[model samples]
Target: MSAAAVPEWLAAEVAALSGAARAGRLPHALLIHEAPGAGGDWLAHFAAQLALCERAAEAPCGSCTACRRVLAWQHPDLTRVAPLEDSRQIRIEQLRDLAAELALTSHAGGYKVGILTPATR
Candidate 1:
C-alpha cells in the first residue's frame, strides 16, 4: 500500500519509523500491538518494506520491486512467523527456526526482517 494509504491513526507511527530508518537509528526490533482489525499486520509489513526497499532514500516507496515483493509476501529477506495450522500458539521450534533464519546473511545483502504475528499467542 502507498504511504498515503496508511490509516490516519497510523500515520504518525509510520512517520516516526520512516524517520528512524532514514537516520539509521531504527531499533533492531519492534513490537506492534493492535486491536483485532486495526491493521497491525499492514504496519509490520510496511516496516519491513522500509528496511528492505531497494531505494533506500525513498524507502517503502511502495512501488519498488522490493516493496512489491513485500506486499506479495514473496520477499526472500522477509520471514513471517505465525502459529502452525490448527494451532493457537506458535511452537518453540518455529521461533528457533526463525532465529536460525535471521542468523544467516540476507539474500539481498540488505536487512533481514522477521515478523511474528499475534505475539500475544
Candidate 2:
C-alpha cells in the first residue's frame, strides 16, 4: 500500500517509530494504547510492518516480500496474540506461548513482533 493508507493524524507517531526501527533503537516489544476507534490497531499493524520491514527506509513499502506477508497476516516474524471471545482475558498460557516463540529464530532472521491486543479484555 501507499503512504496514503496511514492517516495524516498518525504521521508523527509512525515517523518516530519508524525512525527508531531504522536506528536500531526500537525495543523488542511495544505497548500501544488508545481509546476505541483511536486507530490503535492500525497503528500497531503499521508499526509492526515497520519493525519487520527488511528495507525500513521504505517501510510499508507495499512491494517488499516482508511487507506483503505482514499485511496478509502471513509473516512468520509476526505473532499476534489477542484475547479470544471465549476467554475474554489474556491468559497466562498466551503470554507463555508468546515467550517461547520469541525464543526461537525468526523466519526472516529479523525483528520478531508479538502484538497483544485487547490487553484488558
Candidate 3:
C-alpha cells in the first residue's frame, strides 16, 4: 500500500517514526504490535519504504523505485520471516537464517529490514 493509504488513526505514529528517521533520531530497530485489522503490517511497510526512499519526502513517494519495491514485496533489503509451511510456528532455523541474512549489507545500499511474523502456536 502507498503512504496515502495509511490509516488516519496511525498518522501520528507514522509521522513520529518517519520524522525521527529523517532527522536521524530513529532507532535501528523497531517493533510493531497490533490486533487484527489494526494496520500494523501497513505501518511497518510504510516506515521501511520511507527509510529507503531516495527523495526523502515527508512521506514515501509511491512512484519511487524503493517505494515500488516495498509495496510489491520485491525489495532485496526487506526480508520477511514467517512460519514454516507445515509447522504453525517459526523455527529456530528460520531465525538463524534471518540472522545470517542480516549479517550482510543491503544490496540496495539502504538499511536492511527484517519483517518477522511470530508463530501463534
Candidate 4:
C-alpha cells in the first residue's frame, strides 16, 4: 500500500503500537471510539496487519505474506464485528463471540484484533 492511502495520524499510531507489540508491552484489548467516518475499522485492520506482518518495520509492510492475507480479508487472526444485516444494534452474542476468540492465543503469535464498530452498551 502507498503512503497516501494511510493518514499521518493513523500511521503514527500504527508505529507506536508496532513498537509495543515488538517489545511485548502491548495491551490485550483496545477500545476505539470514533464517528461514522473516522476510519476506525480501517485503523483496526491496519493494526491487525501490523501485528501479523512478518516484515513489520514500525508499520505493516504490505508485501509480506501475512499482510497480503490481511489485505485480502482472509487472515485467520483478524476478526471484525459489526451490526448484523437484520439488526441495527450490536447484539450481546456478538460480543460473546469476540470474547471467546480473543481468549485464545493468536495464530501467528501476534495480536488478535477485534474491531467492534459503533459499540453498543
Candidate 5:
C-alpha cells in the first residue's frame, strides 16, 4: 500500500497544506471551488492522500502502507462528496455523511480528509 508519486502541481499544494497541518492551522472544513475540467477534484484527492500517507518525506513517499491504500482509492480516511445521478446539487444529507467520516479517527494515525468538490445548484 504505497502512495503514487504526487504530480508537480499537487506537490506544491501539499507543501502548503503540510505546513498548515504542522502548524495546526488547517481548517476543519475545506471547500474546493473550481470550474469544470479544472482538475479540481484531482487536487482535492491528492491533498487527501498526502494527509493520510504514512511515508516519511517532505512529500508522500508513495511507498508506505497507507500510501498504497490511498493510491488504490481504498483509503478509509479519504471521502469524496459529489452529486448523484439525476441530481444537480449536493444535498445536506451527503454533507452529513462526510462530516461523520471526518469526525472519526484516522486508521493510520493521520488526518482524515473530506474533499468537497464544486457546489452544484
Candidate 6:
C-alpha cells in the first residue's frame, strides 16, 4: 500500500517508524497490538519494508524492487510465520525454526525480517 493510503489513525505510527528507520534507531522487535482486521498485518509488512527497502532515503517507497518483493512475500530475507494447515496455533517447532532462520545471515546482506501473523492466536 502507498504511504498516502495509510489510515489516519495509523499515520502517526507509520511516521514514527519511518523516522526510526531513517535514523537507524529501530528496535530489534516490535509488538503491534490491534483488534482483528485493524491492519496489524499491514503495519507489520510496512515495518519490514522500512527495514529492507533499497532506498534508505525514501524507505518503504512501496514501488522499489525490495518493497515489491516484500509485498509479494518473495523476498529471500523475509520470513513469515503462521499456523500450519489444520492447526489453530503456531507450534513450538515453527517458532524454533523461525528463530534458527532469523539467526542466519541475511541473503541480501541487509536487515532480515520475520513476521508472525495472527499472533493473537
- Candidate 6 residue runs with Cα over 4 Å from true position: none
lDDT for each residue of candidate 2 in 1-121, tens digit (9 for 90 to 100):
5777878888888878878877879866667778888988888888878877777678767778887888788999888888867977888998999999998998888778888888665
What is every candidate's alpha-carbon RMSD to the true fold? 0.9, 1.5, 1.9, 2.5, 3.4, 1.1
Q: What lDDT does each candidate get?
A: 0.91, 0.82, 0.79, 0.75, 0.66, 0.89
How do the residues 33-115 of candidate 5 rate in per-residue lDDT, one tens digit apiece? 66776666666665665567665453355667666676677888877677888777788999999888888887767788766
**Residues 20-70, candidate 4, lDDT per residue (tens digit)?**
877867666667676767777777777777677877564577777788888
Q: Provide the global lDDT of candidate 5 against the true structure.
A: 0.66
Score every model by TM-score.
0.96, 0.90, 0.88, 0.77, 0.71, 0.95
Error of 1 at 112 (Å): 0.4
Cα displacement (angstroms), candidate 3, residue 73, comes to: 1.2
Per-residue lDDT, model 1, residue 12, is 89
Deviation from native of the Cα of residue 67 in model 2, angstroms: 1.0
The weakest ten consecutive residues by lDDT in model 3 span 112-121
> What is the per-residue lDDT of model 6 for residues 20-117, given as tens digits with 9 covering 90 to 100?
98788988999999987888988998999999988888888888999999999999999999989999898889999989999999988999998987
Candidate order by lDDT, highest to lowest? 1, 6, 2, 3, 4, 5
CA RMSD (A), model 4: 2.5
Runs in model 2 with CA error above 4 Å? none
TM-score-better candidate, 2 vs 6 = 6
| Model 1 residue 44 lDDT score | 93
Candidate achieving the largest lDDT = 1
Q: List the residue pairs that clash in candidate 2.
A: none
Ranking by TM-score: 1, 6, 2, 3, 4, 5
